[model samples]
Target: MVDFYPLARKAEVLHVPMEVYLMFRAAGGPDILGQSAAVSLLDWFELDTEIIIVMERPSPSMDLVTYSTLHYPLPEDTVRDIMRQLVLAVIDLHNKRVFHRDLKSNNVLIQETEDGIRVRIISFGCGCIVSTIPYTSFTGCLSCAPPELFLERKYMDSPTSVWQIGGVAYELFNEDSKFFNTYEWFIDALGMKTSITASEEGKHFIQVCLEESPSKRISLEELERHPWFFTTT
Candidate 1:
């Protein structure tokens, strides 16, 4: 994939996406859900104040946003399956000390095969290292960002990621409805909104992911063990 960024957007060069691709390579070049991540960097150049970054193309794929929008309100089983893979992908990134700060549906590339649907995380433009503590600078899709990011301007890695995962879950099960656009609507949704038709366990899973307090949010490891992901076949 080729990324073109106009230099006019910022006064100084910010090659965060390229840096993240390099970081992913250094961290064992992992693949999530059978799709490869930012592979070897292809090329980089500047032309007339525009920066171009060339990367290995993840062909024959669509983003999660596009896929979900096409198949809105996916079945509970399908949602559980997709969420399981997504959680595992996030866990892999966290274990490698890489924090994909801008984790939204658009950043996840989805590919369907005869075997099954798979995914690869892309667009690391806003990613950062997890060890770099006290992240006061917030960067990511505003709607998917955690409450702490909006409320305190600082957030921990695990909790913030959990919140973003919850946002993804919301879109998956809520017919592409966003979670945090308006304060009143969000409050109503959080209070177990009437429109929610998911099972109690499913609701609990999302609720844990959207926990207001970082310390209280569900960890990826715990999420992996959640019953929703282990329903009888």
Candidate 2:
């Protein structure tokens, strides 16, 4: 709600979720893309002053924050499970040229059913189509924002998103990592406010994600095949 676009530019911004859905649709529909990652956009309509968007309602579910709180100090296996699914979903989005700028845990949903815990990334209000050019504006959540935004004042697509994933993982292990500012992030190998003890590979993976230099950070493909992913669950 903080970032406001002119009324003339409403469609471009407000329609982000719908456009992304259509893009996923244009990519041979969700059936091909795997609808498990995101919620289905049932329909949409536009009026004079406002627009209405209808989306799927997955019941018996809760946001990741709530889930994590209920099960604080998540086991390495659970963290690996969650991160693996998250990485795949992000890869899917980027492959389709959709950049989910806002990817904090709050925006992710964990659905419980006979199928087990399913992670669904929600809230595309701050999303944008992928681009090579760096974005100057900040539509993402501040808590999980990339460090480059505070340092260089600009960030690209993949790097920032990867950093966000790292931030999520870090918070899962280190509760003190929440609502962290730029200076309050990690210092050395592990975070300064280290809480939980994780495996070496897991720690390495998280560190790589939070790497300050985008060039050194883990790429989405590398992140998917990351050793930590297969080490446990």
Candidate 3:
């Protein structure tokens, strides 16, 4: 059992019932069930820290809701550091045979500490061990999800993390996401209508990380050595 401490004793609340519950419940319990699964997954990795939890406040105003707020937005330089930490943390989780089926900014949290930026990947409510493989299938943020996950197969693996991490890297460096603006716009941008383009090394790294085929995606260890990371420092 792990102990969860409160990061912020008091914080503002934002209540927005996620659509995943309604959509999955209507679908007859897709791969994973409820937010607990996501919370559980993060626990297995031992990445659930107080730094990730601002405060847990009851919100009777909204039906079935909870809210918390962080101290500040993660800085760009700090984002790079946390990305490195996450890469190592993720590799360790995989070694333990766990997979974070759902990876997204909303699911990740950051805390500023005297030592440095502390990161905690939260919301394992949809998390599952690689072997158990939840009966509730297809859990992930639409933008970060790899193409294969959306296909008829309905199963996700480690590479899913790679793609999502790629999306994170793009967001951290560019301050925008293809998925955040508009679905159609993101699609059109991916189709080569956008002016955005990273350097050769950065482009190659992102491309490999976002590869549709899991086999082609770069491993976390490989990502550690990417020039983008080194160049940032």
For this target, which candidate reaches the highest lDDT against the unseen true structure? 2
Q: Please give, for residues 35-154, the per-residue lDDT of candidate 2 as tens digits.
A: 557776655556566656666667778998899889987888998899999999888888877788888888888888787888887777678778899998888677678888888899
- Tens digits of per-residue lDDT, candidate 1, 1-233, equal 43432222227554434453434342323232233443334555666655566555555788887887778767788778778888888888888677888777777777677767766677666777676477887777776777777778888888888888877776676743654432433667644344555777787888899877788899889988998887743
For model 2, the superposed segments whose C-alpha errors exceed 4 Å read 1-34, 175-181, 186-193
Q: Give candidate 1 regions above 4 Å deviation.
A: 1-23, 26-41, 46-50, 179-185, 190-192
- TM-score ranking from best candidate downward: 2, 1, 3
Best by TM-score: 2
Positional deviation of residue 206's Cα in model 1 after best superposition, in angstroms:
0.5
Q: Which model, 2 or 3, shows the larger lDDT?
A: 2
Candidate 2 matches the true fold with a TM-score of: 0.82
Candidate 3 local lDDT, 1-233, one digit each (tens): 33332222128342212222212222212233222212221111223341232222112221101111122233445555766766765665566555666666566555444665444555544544555352336665665666665564554566767777776655554423333222332465565323334555555666677666667788777887876677652
Question: Whole-model lDDT, candidate 3?
Answer: 0.49
lDDT of each: 0.68, 0.74, 0.49
Model 2, residue pairs in steric clash: none
RMSD of each: 6.4, 5.0, 12.6
